[model samples]
Structure formats: C-alpha cells, structure tokens
Target: MSALELVLLLVLVTDPFGNLPLVLAALGRLDAAAYRRAVVRESLFAFGVLLVLGWGGAGLLQAFGITQPALYIGGGVILFLLSLRMIYGNAQGAFDDGYAADPLLVPIAVPAIAGPAAIATVILLRTQQAVPLSQLVLGLLCALLITLATFLPGRRIAAWLGPRGVNAMEKLTGLLLNLIAVNMMLEGVRRFLG
Candidate 1:
C-alpha cells in the first residue's frame, strides 16, 4: 500500500477518539503541566516503539514465516477485543494499583497509545514491499505525530463533545472497529483460501 494508506490505516487502528475517556480519567488528578507532559511523553514513547517495529518488523515476521493475513486477523482481533472490552467495561483490569494515580505512562503508554494493533499494522506495512523503507518510516512517524497532536487535546475535545457527544463518538468509533474486525477476518479467510 502507499505511504498515505499506511498512515491513515495506522491512525484508524490507533483510534485517538477511543483514547479520550482514558485521557480524561488518567489526567483528572494531574495538574495542567503534568497532564501536558504526560500526554507528550506517552505519545512520543509510543511513537518510538512503533517506529522501531516499523523499521525492522517485516524481516522479523518473514523470518518466522508469518503470513500477512495472519498478522491482520490476529492484530485486528486483539484490537477489536481491546475496543470492545473497554466499551463494555470488560477491560477494567488493564491497569494495576497505582495505575490510576500515574497511568500517564504505564497503561496509556504501552497499550493505549502504542498498542498491539498499531504495532501489527506497522509489521503489515513492511510487507507491502513496494513502499521504500524511508517512506514507511515517514508514514508511521506522520501517523504517530498525528496521534500525539490529536490525543493531547483530547480532554478539551471531550469537554466540547459533552457526555452525550462523547458517548455518541465512542459508539461510532466502536462500530468502525467492529467493521475492521470483520474485514480482518475476511482477509484472513481469503488468504487461507488462496
């Protein structure tokens, strides 16, 4: 796929809107400066992780003989579940004690931001082959940057949306994720059949 496609796909799978609630909860206790710092740190850290994975991911997966469809389905399932669980309150244990107090880096950093889905998408981007490595890096970085910018202002955005608006957007994004899950399953079936 093209660099633009890769970036957009990453953005969709990452789903900053899904993160708004998390941001609001985590930052509820922090002061303004700390909130901003945490936002920048978590997003940048997540970006760095994805950048490394995007650069070397294809070779690692190829070495393991993992097929593209396998990655897609597996990653999508994990992501879909993550979204589903969060939406349905089935993912309450994503953090341990003290997490609620300082979750800016732990749960938010590792999974909420970088996330399994984004990591898998980076690997899939590697298999595209037509795209140059530099372009791939650029795409991933661009998407991550977008995530950083988007997520930083999430609290404000959430406020503007109000509870009703936020819930509406959350459900809409959830529906989108459900579609992504079905697409991933279909891709896996197609590849297996082929």
Candidate 2:
C-alpha cells in the first residue's frame, strides 16, 4: 500500500471509535475539566509509545528473539479476546475502575488506543519494507492526531449517544476488530508456513 493508505489503515487499526466505549466508560466518573485533561494526556502518552516502538521495536524484538509472525499472532489473539468482551457486553471487567484518579496511561492509552494491533502494525511497517522512518513516524502521528480528535469532544458525544447508542457502536466496532484480528492471524500463519 501507499504511504497515505498505510496511514489510513493504521488509523482504522488504532480503532479509536471502537475504543470509545472504553474511553467513555473510564471518563464517566470524571468531571468535564478532568475529562479533557485526561484525554489529551492519554493521547500524547499513546503517541509517545507508538513513536518509540516505531523506531526501536524491531531491535527490541530481535533482542528478545521474537519473530514477526509471533508478534502478529499474539497481537491478534489479544485483540480477538478484547473484541469478544465488547460483543458480549461484559467489557467492564476488561476496563480499569471508574474510580481511577486518571486512567490516562492504562486502559485508555495503552491497550485501548495504542493497542497490540497498532503496535504490531507500526513495527511491521517499519521493518518489512524500505519505507523511510520519517514516513512511518508521520503515519503514527496522523493516527494519534485522529485519536485525539475523536477523544476531545467525547463528553458531548457520550451525551448524544447515551448508554444504548454507545453499546451499539461498541458492538459494531467489536465486530470490525474481530475481522482485523482474524486477518492478522491468517497473515501470521501464512508467513510462518512460507
């Protein structure tokens, strides 16, 4: 794929919309001011993580003797399980408690936004081709910016969507995630066999 297409796919895999339920659920207990601060902080945190991984992830994996297929399969399994939780309406246990002073870097930023799929995508993109490091970073930045945009107006969105609407959206997102997860797994298997 072209660089722009890769960036777009990364944004989709980042799955900010899919993660809205989790982000909104975590933010539900916060006041408006706190919510806005948390969103910005978490977005930056996720971006930093992605940037680091984009630059150093291949080296780190090599140091640990991990293969690309392993990364793909492992990430796919984690995403599949998370998506299942969303589909079954049992996602609460998967999230941090609402009482967290700030769930900035944990559920919201880590696995929710800069998730396994996203991390693996960055690493794969960086290592699999002659693509410039700058371009990979650019893609990561674009994806994170889109995530920030989605999250900044979250309160208004939650209010407009209400509980049921959020749930429906979450289910749809979960379904999409499942498809991505399966594709990842299949690709991993193909690479491993080849």
**Best-matching candidate per lDDT:** 2
Give the 10-residue window scoring lowest on summed lDDT in candidate 2: 90-99
Question: What digit string (tens of lDDT, one per residue) describes model 1 on residues 1-194?
Answer: 66676677777666676676776677678887888888888877877887788788888888999887788778778767766755664222454345665564567767876788778767766664446668877876787678777667777887888877866666676677667767776787788788
In candidate 1, the residue pairs with backbone N, CA or C atoms under 3 Å apart (3 or more residues apart, or in different chains) clash, namely none
lDDT score at residue 126, model 1, on the 0-100 scale: 68
* Local accuracy by lDDT, each model: 0.72, 0.77
lDDT of 2 by residue, 1-194 (tens): 68787777677667776677677778877888888889889888888888898899889889999987888788778768767877886444666555475674888788777877778777877776445788887888888778878788866776898878777877887787788778878888988999
Error of 1 at 79 (Å): 3.3
Q: Quick one: best TM-score, which candidate?
A: 2
Clashes of 1: 0
Candidate 1 ranges with C-alpha deviation above 4 Å: 2-4, 86-100, 128-130
Worst 10 residues of 1 by lDDT: 89-98
